[model samples]
Structure formats: structure tokens, C-alpha cells
Target: MIESWRWYGDLDPISLSEVAQTGARGIVTALHEIPYGEVWPSDTIVARKAQVTEAGFDWLVVESLPVHEHIKRGDGDLSELFANYRQSMANLAANGVHTICYNFMPLLDWTRTDLEAPVAGGATCLRFEAVRMAAFEVHMLGRRAAEGDYSPDVLTKAAAWFQRASEADRDALLASIMAGMPGAFDRYDVAGLRVALAAYEGIDRDALRQNYKRFLDEVVPTAEDLGMRLCVHPDDPPRDILGLPRIVSDGDDLAWVLAAHDSPANGITLCSGSLGANPINDVPAIAAQVADRIHFAHLRNVTKDPDGSFEEAAHLEGDTDMVALVKVLLDEQSRRRAEGRADHTIPFRPDHGHHMLSDLGRDMIPGYPLIGRLRGLAELRGVISALSHG
Candidate 1:
């Protein structure tokens, strides 16, 4: 694996020089300055690439080239949006950035209920509690029919959780879920959330899956044309949230997607933290199945609770067997090497690290504190080294 780190442009507190110090030679980033569905100017792409190059790092992967709400909802003028996306792909390819990672989760990007849940050893990590999410949906967002999705027991627990949550807790929970302010829920207010929820009111799982297929059918050809790999990120939590549909949660879901286009360009990002949030997803098994088509990876682990809550754990100390996963990745790398594939060495980042060390009390991007991710990278490097040689 080619180790990389995610950089959120100029506003990111961790400078490119700082990222280089962590021994990450590749940078995984996107144009957060550009709004959703807009064309990323070639000038901007070139300038950004130059910035990374100057920092002694290669811009190896785009963490995302967002698929806009207009496309996801199967509403509005898709032709214009599709054209813009295609142009962005062309611009990125022209600038030498070939792998693009994106997600199709509606309304929100990877969400969590708590951004600073205290963990053992006096550190903080991101967490997703199903009951708390349920509470947000039923009592906060007040999405109609949300109560029906939960079992009687879970609903009862959710109600109790909502009752006990203080005002500050409620605001924090709302902010955590609305991270990045994905277009559909950009306003981040109750009314805006309701409007966004209403847009997906009639769309069910099957409809959403069909919409995802349509998106691939239209975009995958362009990706292949530009010699770019489009890797779809899995839905975080890998389950329905706020009564919305999530199709890319499990192996079967990914298999369906790979089958949709049957091309190498139609690949997966394979985020372990997102998929592992649901205990049912076997991370190593999924890695094996999708290894061939995985263009990018986000390798972090999660410790899941029986009540469906999960906390981001250290790289090697969670529910996932990081060593086994690394072994499989190494095997895949060997196979690719034998095949003489240029992209044989996959690019991956130590995702969602805990807030620890000097990063404590600093205003930093949650899950992306400098010292914690450096620790994760060091831990993962040891595993990869041991597995590759042994």
C-alpha cells in the first residue's frame, strides 16, 4: 500500500509540510472550495497539484468529487450536472490525478452522533450511537415514519435517550451528523432538514439503488474514456438513517455495483470504518472480494457495541483484524505487481484517528488531528512491513 493522508485544502490546520513529516508521500484531497456539482477549473487542479508537488508529496487520490443532490435524487436537470462532472473528470485527468473517490449517501456524508466521545487512555474519538441517531430523527428532525423503522425496544430506548439529552448535547449531535453540509442538507436548520427529508419521502431502497446504477451507467464510461478510476465510497454506518435508503453497505451491495458497469474504472474506495460500523460486515472478507477493483482505501478500525453504537478505535485494536486485512492487501499488491499493472500499489490513508497527544484542545478537524493520525500511520506501517516480509 502507498501510504497517504487527507488534506482539506488551505483551511486545514495540518499543513502539507506537516503531512510530509508523518512519512505520507501521497496526499488524498479534494476541492472543498468548489461547491457541489460545479466544474472544477483546470487551473485550480493544476495549482493544487503544484502545491502538493512543492511539499514533496504526490496528490495520489481525490478523496471525493461529489455527486450532487440533483443526480442522487433522480430529480432536476441531470444532463447539465453530468456534463459538469464529466468535465471535472477530464480536468483531473489532464492534471495527472487519476483515482477519484466519491459516495452516494443522500443528505449527509459519513455521519456520527458524537465528535468527541471520551475513550480509554484519556483520548477522544468519533462515535455513532444508533439510539442517539434515532433520537435525532424522531425528536430532533421529526422525520415522519422514522419511529416505524426502529424496533419497539430501540424506539423505547431512543425516546429515553432523547429525554435525557441536554440542549448542548442536542446541538452537538446535529452538527456532527451535518458535517460538510452536503447540498441537500446545507442549511443545517430544522426546516432545511425537513425539506431535505421530504425530497426523499417516496424514494425507497430499490429506487435509490436504481438511481445509483443510473449514475454509474452515465459516469463510468467517461471515467474510462479519461483513464480514471471512479471509486464509490461505502455508506457510513452501512444502514438506513433518518428513514433514508443506503444501498452500499455490504459485499452484496458492492457486487451489484461492480456488475453494473463491469469495468475496472468502476471501483470502490473500501473504507473499513464506514463498513465496519455494522458488526455484520466482515472487513477482511469484503477486502478479498473487492481487492481487484479497489482503487483507494480508508483503513481505520471501530469498536462496536451491542446497542449499535461504535467508536473509532486505534488502527490495530478494534473489531477489524488489521493484520489479516493488510495481508490480503499485500497479496493483492503482489498479484498486481505480477500483472504489471501501474496502479498495483494501492493508495490508502490512516482514516479517522483519535484526538490525542498535542492535538488535544486544538481546533482541528474531528478525526484528523495531526499527532493521532501520525500514530495510526506508524502503527499501520509496522503491520504492513511485518506482513509483507513474513
Candidate 2:
């Protein structure tokens, strides 16, 4: 496996020099400054690559080249957007960055109700609580159909939670749920969220899947031609949220996607944290099932509750069997090597670590603190070493 780190470009608080110290040679990043639906100028790609190289590291993967909303919703004539996406792929490939990771989650990226949920050892981690999300949807956002989406028990809990939540609490909850990621340009207010939700009113699971398939049909060929791999990230919570359909959630969804466009370029980013949020997903089994198609991996874990709430756990501490999953991925790498495949090794990163040690009190991205992720990387590296030699 090729160990990698996700850097949010120049503005990231964690510097490349710092990343090098973590012993990860591959940098997984994106041109976040580029807006969605725009062509990534070749010069910009070269400049970014220069930055990574100058820091003595290689830009091994594009964490995302975002898919525009128009493409996902099948709205209007997206020919221009498709053209731009293909051009971006070509530009990336032209610069020797072949592996691209992206997601089709509508409106928002990965979300959490609490960005600083308290965990043991006085560290904080990201969490998604069902009642809190329901509170935000029904009581705060006041989505008319929100009540029908959640179970009666959840609704009751949400109502209770909403009643007890103070003004500051409500505001934080709304911000936490609606705010864009670290470098995102757009942030949604209540009205904006409602408008976004309305846009997807008629698009259900099947329609969304078809839209995704359409996107693959358009972009995967370009990737194949460019010798690039386009890996779709699974839904963060691995389930439907805010009345939106999540097609890439489980093993069956993965199977459907692989079959939708059968090509080595059309692949999956095996995110254990996201899939592990749903108790039903066997992370190790899914790893083995999609071993050949997994172009990249996010090795993080989460502790789940029966009521559909979960918190990011330490890489090796959560419900996922990290050692077992690593063993499966390593075995697959060996098989690919024996088969003489050039892209035999998988690139993986330790994702969403807790804010511990020097990471606390730092104004870093929610789950991407320096010390926390360093610890995770060290732990994962240790596992890989033990498994390989054992």
C-alpha cells in the first residue's frame, strides 16, 4: 500500500514539511481553489504539483475533482459541465496525476452534528447523532417532510432535544450541519438549504443512480483514455439524509456501480469510516469484495450506536477490524503483483483522527488535526508492517 496524506492546498494549517515528518510520501490533495464545474487550468495543476514536489513529496492522488450539482441532478444541458470535467481529467492526466477521488453526494459534503464531540482521554472527535440531525431538519430547518423521514422514536427524541437545546446550541447545530468543508466556497443558510432540498424533490434513489451512471458514462471513458482511475467516494453516513438518496452506501450499491460501468477506470474509494457507520456493512468483507476495483482507501473507524448515531473512533479502536482489513488489502496487492498489474499497490490515508495532544486548541479542519492524523498514520503503518512480515 502507498501511504498518503490529504492536504487542503496551501491554506491548510498543516504544512507539507509537517506531512513529510509523518513518513507519508504520497500527498492526496485537490485544487480546492478551483470552483466546481470549471476546467482546472493546466498551469494551476503544474503550480500545485510544483509546490508538492518542492516540499519533497509527490502529489499521488486527487482527493476530489468535484462533480458539479448540474451533473448530479441531471438538470438542464450539462454538456458544458461534462466538457469541463473531461478537460479537468485530461489536464490532471497531462500532469501525471492519474488517480482521482470524487463523490456524488448532493448539496453538502460529509456532515456532522458535532465537530467537537468529547471522547475518552480528553480528546475530541467528529460525531453524527440522529436526534441532533433530526432536530436540525425538523425543528430548525423546518423541512415539511422531515418528520416522515425519521422514525417516530427518533422524532420524539428530536423534539425533546430541540426543546432542551438553547439558542446557541441550535445555532451551532445549524452551522455544523450546513457549513461547507474546510475550503468550500459556499455555505448554506436555512433558506438556501430548503431551496437545495427542493431541487432534488422528484429525484429518488433510482433517478439519482441513473444520474450517477450517466456521469460515469460521460467521464469514465476519458479517465480510461487518460490512464486515470476515477474512484467514487461512498456517502459519509452511508445512508439517506435530508431526504436525499445515497446510492453508494453498501456492498450492493458498490456492485451496482461496478456493473453500471464496467471498467478499471471506474472504481471505488473504500472508505471504512463511512461504510462502518452503518452496522450492516462488513468492512473487511467489502474490502475483499471490491479489492480489485478499490483505487484508494480511507482507513478510519467509527463507533456506532443502535439508534443510528456514531462517533469517529481511533483507527484501530472502532467497530472495524483494522488489522483484518489491512490483511485483506495486502493480500489483494500480492495477487495483483503476481498478475503483473502495474497499479497493484493501493493508496490509503488515515482519515478523520481525533483532536489529541498538540492538536487540541488548534484552529484546524474539524477532523484533520496534525497530531491526531499523525498518530493514526503511525498506527496504521505499524499494522501494515506487522501483517506483511507475520
Candidate 3:
């Protein structure tokens, strides 16, 4: 495994110099300044790569080159967008950046109910409470069909939760859900969210999957031709949210997409924290099964609740079997080495970390603080070293 760190260029409170100190040699980042559906020029890609190299880090992967909303919806002149995406892939490959991570989730990227939920160690971590999210979907967003999506018991509980939530609580939930993620272009207001949902009104799970297939059909060949690997990130939370269809949530969904474009160039970005939100996903098993097709990995853990809520837990302390997963990854690396594949060693980053120690109250990017992630990287590195040698 190649240890890496995600760096939000230019605006990241944590500098590249600081990232170098964490013992991570590879940098996972993107050309975030460019708007979605536009071309990432070769010069821009080279310039960013130069910055990483100058800082003594390899530009290992693009955490995302966002899939345009128009492409996801199959609406409004997709040819232009697809052409732009292909050109960007060409530019990235031309600059020796071959791995591209992207997602196909419609409307929003990842849905979380709280960005600063208090944890046991006096640190704050990202959390997703089903009841709070349900409250937003049913009472706040007021989606007409939102109630049908939840069970009777869930709906009742959500109603009660909403009733008891003060204005500040409700406001916090709204901000957390609506806030834009790094490299995303789909941030929304209440009306904007409703309108975004309306775009996918007639599209269900099957239709959305088909749309993604169409995208792969158009883009995968270009990626292969450019010697670029495209990795699709799993849907965060791994379930339906606000009635939006979630096509890449579990192993079955992963198999569906992999079969859609059976090529080494078309792969998956295995995110343990995202998939582990749903208790049904066995993180280690999935990693072993998808080892051949995994181009990147996001290693983090979560403590799941029976009611479909979860909080980000320390890397080694959550429901995920971190040791088993690392063992599988090591085995996969060995397998790749035996086969003499150039990209045998997968690039992985400590996904999201708690805002603790020096990170507290720093106005940093949510879920991305310096001290917490360094701690995670150190822990993961220790485990990898111990297992690899033992």
C-alpha cells in the first residue's frame, strides 16, 4: 500500500509542507478551481503537479474529477460535458497523473446530519443521525414522498425528533446537509435542493444505474487509451437519502458497476467509512473481493447504531476490522507484485478525521484537520509495518 494524504490545494489550512511531515509521500488532490464540466488544461495539471513535487510529495491521485450533474441526469447536451471529461483525462495522463477518483451520486455528494458531533474523547467528528436526517427530509425539505421512504417507526421517531429540535438544531442540520464538499459544484439551498431532487423525479435506482453505465461506455475507453484509471467512489451512507437513488452503496452495487465496464481502467475507490455506515457491508470481505479492481482506498471507521445512525470513530476503534482489512490489502499488494503490474501498490489516504488537539476550533475544512489525520496515518503506517514484517 502507498500511504497518501488528501490536500485541498491553495486554501487548505494545512499546508503541503505539513503533509510531508506525516510520513505520507503521495498527495491525493484535484484542480478544484476549475468549474465542473470544464476542461482541466494540461498546464494547470502540470502546475499543480509541480507544486506537489516541489513540496517533496508525489501527486498520486485525483480524489475526484467531479462528474457533472448534466451527465448524471443524462440531460442537456451531454456531448460537450463528456468531451470535456475525456479531454481532462487526456491532460491528466499527459502530465503523468493516471489515477482519477470520481462519484456518480446525483444531487449531493455525501449526506451528513452533523459536521461537528461531540464524541467521547472530547473531540468532534462527523456524524449521520438517521432521525435528524429524516427530520430534514420529511419536515424541513418537505419532500412529498419522503414519508414513504421511511418505515412507520422511523417516521414516528423522526417526527418526534423534529418536534423536539430547537431552531438552532434545525439550522445546524440544514447547514451540514447543504454545505458543499471539496471539489463539488452542487451545494444547495432549501429550494435548490428541492429542484435538484425534481431533476431525478422519474429516475429510480435502475434508471440511475443505466445512466451511469452510459457514462462509463462513453468515458472508459478514453481513460484506457490515455493509460488513466478511473475509480468510482461508493455512495456515502450507502443508502437512499431524500428519495435520491443510491446505485453504488454495497458490494452488489459495486459488482453491477464493475460488470458495466469490465476493464482495469474502470475501477472502484474503496471507502471503508462510507460503506461501513451500513452494517451489512463487510469491509474486509469487500476489500478482498474487489482487490483486483481497487485503484484507491479511503481507510476510516465508524460506530454504527441499530437505528441507521453512525458516528466516525477512530481508525482502529470502529465496527470495521482494520487489521483484517490491512492484511487483505497487503496480500493484494503481494499478488500485484507477483503479476508485475505497474499499479500493484494501491494508493490510500486516511479519509476523514476528528477535529481534536490543535485542530479544535480552527475553522478548518470539516472532517479535514491536520493533527487528527496525522494521528490516523501514523496508526495505519504502524499496523502496515508490523503486519508486513511479522
Candidate 4:
């Protein structure tokens, strides 16, 4: 496997020099400055590549070239958006950046109710409590149909939670749930969130899947022609949330996605932490089954509760068997090597680590503190080393 690290460009508090020290040679990133639905200018790609190269790292994969909201909703004149996305793929390929990671989730990216949930050892990790999310959806956002989405038990817990939450607690909950992504807080508010939810009123799971298929049909060919790979990331929690449809959540969804385009260029980003959030998903089994189609991997773990809540666990300590998953991926790599495939080595990163050591006091991005991820990378690297030699 090609060990990689996700760097959020110049503005990221963690510098490339710092990332280099973590012993990761591949940099997984994206042109986040480019707005959704816009073409990534060639010069911008070159400049970013130059930065990574200068720092002694290869621009291995584009963590995401975001899919526009209009495209996901199948709304408006999508011709221009599709054209722009194809052009972006072409531009990325032109720059020798072939592997692209993206997601088709509508409106929001990966979400968590508590960005700084306290864990053992005085460290903090990202957490998603189902009841709190329900509280936000029903009592806070006051979505018209939010009550129907949760079970009666959850609704009761949510109601109790909402009633007991103080004004400050309510505000914090609202802010955390509403926070879209890093640097995206300004884009979403209660009114805007409601409007976004309203736009998806009629689009259910089937419609969203169809829309995703339409997207693949349009761009996968371009990716193949460019010798580029497009990998769709699984849903963060692997379930429906905020009254919106979640199409890519589990193994079946992954199977459908790969079948949608059935090309080497069309693939999936095997995100263990995200997929493992749902206990039903056997993370190692999924890795082995989709070994050939997994273009990239996010190796992290989460401990799930019976009530649908989960918190980030140490890479090796979570419910998912990290060592077994690594062994499966390594075995796949050996198979690809025997088959004489050029893209044999899979690129992976240690995702969403706990804020520990010096990372505790820093005002870093929620789950992306420097020390935490460095620790995760070191641990994952150790596992790969032991498995390969053992």
C-alpha cells in the first residue's frame, strides 16, 4: 500500500513540512478553493502539484472534487455542470493526478454531533449520537417530517434531551450540527438548511441513486479516457440523516455503484471508519470482496453503540479489525502484482484521529489535529510492516 496523508493546501494549519515528518510520501488533497460546479483551472492544479512536489510528496489522490448540489438533485440546466466536472477531470489528469475521490451525498459532507467529544486519556474524538442528531432535527431545525424519521424511543429520548438542554447547550448543538465542513460554517444557517432540505423533498433513496448513476454515466467515460480513476466515498454514517436520502452506505450500495459504470476507472474509496459505523457492515469482508475495485482507502475505526451512536476509536482498537483489513488489502496488492497491473499498490490514509498529546489544546480542524493523525499513521504503518513480513 502507498501510505498517504490528506493535506488541505496552504491554509491548513498543518504544513507540508510537518506532513513529511509523518513519513507519508503521498499527499491526498483537493483544490478546496475552487467552488463546487466550477472547473479547476489547469494552472491551479499545476501550482498545487508544485507545492506538494516541492515538499517531497507526490500528489497521489484528489480527496474530492466536490459534486455540485444541483447535480445531485438533478435540478436545473445540468449540462454546464456536467461539462465543468468533465473538464475538471481532464485538467486533473493533464496534471498527472489520476485518482480522484468524491462523494454524492446531498447538501452536507460528513457530519458529527460533537466535534470534541471527550474520550479516555483526556483526548477528544469526533462523535455522532443518534438521539442528539434527532434532537437537532426535530426540536432545533424543526423539520416538518423529522419526527417520522426516528423511532418512538429515539423521539422520546430526543424530546427529553431537547427539553433538558439549556440555551447554551441548544446553541452549541445547533452550531455543531449546522456546521457544514471546515471553513463552510458561513454557508449554512437554519434558514439555508431548511431550504436545502426542502429541495430534496421528493427525492428519496431510489431517486438519489438514479441521480448518482446519471453522474457516473456522464463522467466515468471521461475518467477512463484520461487514464484516471474516479472513486466514490461511502456515506459518513452509512445511513440516512437530516431527512435526506443516503444512497452509498453499505456493501450493496457499493456493488450497485461499481455496476453502474463497470470500468476500472470507476471505483470506490474504501472508507472503513465510515462503513464500520453501521455494525452490519463487515469491514474486512467488504475490503476483500471489493479488493480490485478499491482505488483508495481511509483506514480508521469507530466504536458503535446499540442505539446508533458512535465515537472515533484508536485505529487498532475500534470495532473493525484493522490488522485483518490491512492483511486483505495487502493480499489484493500481491494479486495485482502477479496480474502485472501497473496500479497495484493501493493508496490509503489514517483518517480522523483523536486529538491527543499536544493536539489537545490546539484550535485545529475537528478531527484533523497534527499529532493525532501522526500517531494513527505510525500505528497503521506498523501494522502494514508486521503483516507484510509475518
- What clash pairs does model 1 have? none
Task: Give candidate 1 regions above 4 Å deviation.
Answer: 183-185
Which candidate number has the best TM-score?
2
- Clashing residue pairs in candidate 3 (N, C-alpha, C atoms within 3 angstroms): none
- Model 3 residue runs over 4 Å out of place are 180-186
For lDDT, candidate 2 versus 3, the one ahead is 2
The better-scoring model by TM-score among 2 and 4 is: 2
lDDT of 3 by residue, 134-236 (tens): 8899899998587776677888999999899999888888899876443545566678878777878788888888889999999999998988899999998
TM-scores of the candidates are 0.97, 0.98, 0.97, 0.97
Best by lDDT: 2
Q: Relative to the true structure, how large is the alpha-carbon lDDT of every model?
A: 0.88, 0.91, 0.88, 0.89
Candidate 2 TM-score, true structure as reference:
0.98
Residue-level error in angstroms, candidate 1, position 25: 0.4
Which residue pairs show backbone clashes in model 4? none
Error of 2 at 362 (Å): 1.0
What is the alpha-carbon lDDT for the whole of candidate 1? 0.88
